[model samples]
Target: MGGPVERPVPEDSAPEQSAADVAPVTVGQGSVDSPSGVERHGMFGVAGSGDTSGFGGLVREPWTAPGAQRPYGSYFDEIVDGLYEAYADAAAAITKVVVERNELTLHIAREHLIGVATALRNDPSLRFELCSSVSGVDYLGSTHRLHSVAHLTSMTYRRRVRLEVSVSVDDPHLPSLTGLYPGTDWQERETYDMFGIIYDGHPSLTRILMPDDWDGHPQRKDYPLGGVPIQYKGATIPPPDERRAYK
Candidate 1:
């Protein structure tokens, strides 16, 4: 009883954080954090030309942002709580939550899109009644290449949040949100046209920006650069939207 007894815990008995619980992040001194969990080889400069400038030799590895820690500042905590209270499978539905640049984004699984959307819209405390926009992105290097994003707005609470769902290019399908937010009809269509993300229950998933028989998604990273040339350097080019045959 001199002062206090200290004991050393065996390394085997001590608690250890598993890799699953770890959220990886890369922070630069004065640069923005991208927070995507994918790495890719990228060329910095000299597009379609030999490396005369040497800038093309450089590869940029953008920082990957970390998942939000507990007690997310501002009303993010309340929003999360409300979602948990409203959705029975909230834990499984919410794949990850990231707070960055003063915005809240919830990465949701595609399977639970409707359930989470319903909860966010109908639940009083988490009344995300409006989906301002629905967009698609191709994180080319990631396992899930296609990403569908919806920006939600709460008119009553004046809060805005984002929901993202990702799926592999081989099996790209997400349930439509037009049933919940009618405004997302054309937005989802445009996204489908641009990135080829098929909204499963969409009223009309036809291409909005391109012809019905358009070949591939124009905005995708792997899409060939074949569109009409706009006299960039007096270079003659062919159109990219060559009709594609559907099986």
Candidate 2:
């Protein structure tokens, strides 16, 4: 299963790449009625009338990386093809493939994240053996507000890819990748601690940064802004904007 698959010499290595080597990977046609990008209204995206930024008149269209078209350039096509070869159900597992800003991201269903990740890692052609980082994104107002993203590297092929999964806030659950990549243990915990994502199969998915009694996940887009009082060593401390005693 770990056999080495020859990589087409990248354009940089050779004067040019052959037509077959640069062929577009046709896996993962786009889905979802709406783009998964975040939508914003007003300068500060203010819900209430506190338009302190004063640029409130400006409205920004959601800039999203829509499902990518064929021939995802670079080694991306190879990676996609390899994943399909390794994973029997690649089509069902992946929601969409987004290649934008010179990067490739595979949005997988949360239920199939592990299997897809496994295929990426074990397949010699795909060889995304290392899960270097795991993090989260909260796209407020989207149907699936929480997104768990993982970055992987293929040491053998000098390639990298991103795997992302989204779940609704009401049921924010995703399988932990610690069993696959031990380093993901703390990264997943930190994501959970900051974003409140519950990693279902995590062995010890406790609060890694926030105190156990902390009121809410601090990093979520919907988390309250820092304007409340804080208790430190049994003494009251004013919020940042209200603080003036240091003078």
For all candidates in order, the CA lDDT equals 0.72, 0.73
Best by lDDT: 2
Q: Candidate 1, after superposition: displacement of residue 36 in Å?
A: 5.2
1-247 per-residue lDDT for model 2 (tens digits) = 3458755433432212122222221323332222444554554444565666666666666655678978999889988888888888788777788898788999887666777887787765777868889999887766666888999998877788999877767777777787678789899999999898888778888998888888888888777566544566656554443353221
CA displacement after TM-score superposition, residue 159 of candidate 2 (Å): 0.4
Clashing pairs in model 1, backbone N/Cα/C closer than 3 A: 35-64, 35-65, 227-240
Clashes in candidate 2: how many?
1
Per-residue lDDT tens digits for candidate 1, residues 1-247, read 1321233323452112222332221222122222343432233322465665544545556355578998899989989998999888888778788899889999887667788887788777777768888898777765566789899998768889999877767777778887777788899999989998888777888888899998889888778876565768875555433332111
Lowest summed lDDT window (length 10), candidate 1: 24-33
Ten-residue stretch with the least lDDT total in model 2: 14-23
- Evaluated against the true structure, the overall lDDT of model 1 is 0.72
Clash tally, candidates in order: 3, 1
